[model samples]
Target: MVNKSKVTINDIAKAVNVTAATVSRALNNNPRISEATRKAVQKAAKELNYQPNNIAAALRHGKSHLIGVIVPRADRAFFSSVIRGIEEIANEINYKVIICQTYEDLEKEAQTIETLVNARVDGIIASISKNTIDFSHYQSAIDKGFPVVLFDRTSDQVTVNQVVIDDYYGAYEITKHLIDQGSKSIAYLTSPIKINIYKDRLRGYMDCLADHNIDYDERLVVESNLQLQDGRQSMEKLLSGQRTPDAVFSASDYGIMGALQVLKERGIRIPEDIALAGFGNEPFTSFTDPTLTTVDQLSITMGRVTAELFFDQLKGSKKKHHEPHKTMLKPGIIVRQSSLKKGLNQENSPISEEYKELP
Candidate 1:
């Protein structure tokens, strides 16, 4: 029987007919080492099944080369796309990533942050949970000189690098599209107003209504957790009221789906009876019976920007005491059958023309 544990760099060095120092330099791809020597060492190492000691390398450099990522939910397509983007960039730079899900729970988010800190991860990237109000947990990591990059949901309480879409502008565009479709009475569906992204969307919705000289009817606004059931319940409640909205602008794609279910059950013709628009252009949005119109949050771009921000901080290019670096991406509107009441093609629609030049 072979003693697998006995395999070491020295064995590869001997096999490659080079000193251990030369082998180490070759493995590390030192510019001084010739490419031929590097390839030889690598080939020998592979043949010998030699594994580099990452823990020792980490200790020597004072960096784990591991990034911690936290999100509200891993199952959501938006969050998953962001993670893929992060992983793509992280892998390119020879770093590994650890992912954690908070399930929209504040306590879980806080605990995850603490755990990541204790694990000595080089940095952290996270989207604040809906129920999170305090940012002291994140501040603790920053206080310890660990860099943090926030994406999607964020807060002003913690000054750190952030990559986010223009939520206010995205909401404004969505509402404006409905109004252009001749939707006189539009209902607004959203989650808790305490969340910064939701608050921004709410502000945009109100502003769009006011811009079109429409009275801000407090009764038309419904606040829920933005769950599928909440969407159906909210829709039912709105229908029960004295004034029924002609359209609904939801903060989530899931909520829009729930609304669709109720509308379909009642044999309501979408766009003709009640138009619908939602945020986050999830994959399912395009596949629905009547494709749902929604906002594309540029999730993958947000993730890539987040990883870049972390690398910038690691290189000391960004000042630790300076104002937080904010990168806001422009979101695009996806026109679909669910919200097109004028029978116009998406390209020729007035709403699309207005936003065609946006980046």
Candidate 2:
């Protein structure tokens, strides 16, 4: 085989009649460089098939312009919105996002995080899985001085930049809304009440019930996997009980949808048989048979803010110790036909329940 020619920035610079520094800046599209020089340098670089070594550039600048986004499920509506938000900003900022889905498995989360770290990403944004208890992988990222921003389902173990919804306040407000609708015995459907968001949501539900002087009924609080099938099964179990709940406040939209389907099949009139409300104002909520009243979390905005946070950290302009930044955006409640009853319980006055307070 003939000897291979090694391409270098110097070769491109010589061809464009410019300094290597100028060629480098032009290759990176630095705004400070003149557009004419950049175009010329780029054309020469392309003609010579010059490929800038990203690994060397990263080593020199101590940045890779790559961010890792770890989530439980990328296909979920909430995660999809968040990814869109992140990708939009990242693209604008000349950055790329490497998405990693752990599938709600702790071991998989550990492996993905490690892989991202090995890739030498500039930063990371993550939403911990329900099964995650140990945070050694997270600590390792922090130890490496790599910025980590947590969003949605974050862990309480490590102090870092975070963007999240006010789960407690949102749940409290929704529960209080159910009580305002004259729902005395409202059932609370949710996943494990151990995670911070769910725990806070459950607390809000209980606090609202207490505020309304409604006795706490353990039987009314049903815990499930928050899946569609689990929702139907849990609701069926609740309906089979001695007493039926007047309303249900679910922390999951999937669960609510499943329960709603079963209730309709069983000829149970919504708002008449049971007033229902759920969280995560998914798009399908509006298209349901009787539109759902649910919590609208600006997940996309959170994702954008999280990406911004990572960018800020990567900027390296810190004066004092980087104070942990936590953003809690308030959730809006969308009230639809599912929560409104007819006849005596009919609501006449229009109440703008959707788009509530922003935390």
Candidate 3:
């Protein structure tokens, strides 16, 4: 075994010719010290090979300056936006974020929540996975007075601060738009309607049909996992039907792209044959051959607002006033070439007039 020397703040303070509190203030960026004094303390710290032990600091304060951010999949563009927002607020308040991906597994989500609780994180921001249903893992965190804010996806059982988009209104508007554009036979391509977002979207689609006296045709609905391949396969099955849909509304950008690929392969003209629209307003949507019409969820704003909400909770006073609150952001529809059939017939471009920048 090798003999290792322990490094302490006192050692750094001595080397810097200052008191331990000054060193601590310098390291923590307390804003009370002069700029020159901070620079000196920092240089001395670097020379001593000093590393601030966050664990020790937490032990002293009885709270960790860390926030746990949990999501179903880190690869998703929507979740990425939310994480960025969380980070923006956290950095401003001297708090750090520990991100965990659950891969849509309830067990994994629970394990990560428990681990964060054990680590004594001061707060948590989470979007529950599609498969998650249990509340035991989250209960301990809530009971311990931890600030928990659920964004995008939340559970009915967990009564905490929540930030979500208006999925129902967005979906309803798009479906009704298609119907108004003379899409008498429209099809809905979406994921499982078990979660709040998808379920709300499906409800919006159904409401649009019901309000217009259009019979709900079960044959026109195709439920898949919202994968690229699912889009292709689902569209192929729809195209094979005797009465093909004149328009299709998908709940995901990836799914829309997949359907577009299949449609293009079959030499089908967009909006002329079968119009298409999707959600998420992905970056690639605008660059597509016929720019994809989509629902802009303003994911980055959602993330930033969620972060603001988390910081508000940390501030104590605001948390007391805002706990058990909910915030809902309206989703905007992005009209593009893929869904501009009516405007084209009228010698006017709907894409130019209808597409607006999302907040």
Best-performing candidate as measured by TM-score: 3
**Cα lDDT of model 1 by residue, 1-359, tens digit:** 32456777788878889999999899888999999999999998877778778657666778888989999889999999999999989999989999999998989999999998877788899999988889999999998878899998999889988888999999998899899899989998988658789989999999999999999998988889888999999899888988999999999998888888899988988989999999998999989989899999888888888898888788783453646778988898888889988876656665562224254
- Between prediction 2 and prediction 3, the one with superior TM-score is 3
- State the lDDT at 226 in candidate 1: 86
Query: Which ten-residue region of model 3 has the weakest summed lDDT?
Result: 344-353
**Judged by lDDT, which candidate is best?**
1
Candidate 3 per-residue lDDT over residues 1-359, each given as its tens digit: 21125567788777778999998898878889888889998887777667777666777887788989999888888888878887887798878899999998989999999888878888899999888777777877887777889998887788888899989988988887788678889899978748788888999999999999998898889999888999999899899986699999998888889999999999999988999999988888899989998998888889889989877777773344554788999987888888877764434422233555443
> What C-alpha lDDT does candidate 2 achieve relative to the native structure?
0.84
Residue 45's lDDT within candidate 1 is 80
| Model 3 TM-score (2 dp) | 0.88
* Backbone clashes, each candidate: 0, 1, 0
Which residue pairs come into collision in candidate 1?
A: none
List the candidate 2 regions with Cα displacement exceeding 4 Å: 1-26, 29-52, 316-320, 342-354
Model 2 lDDT-worst window of ten: 342-351
RMSD of each: 3.3, 3.3, 3.2
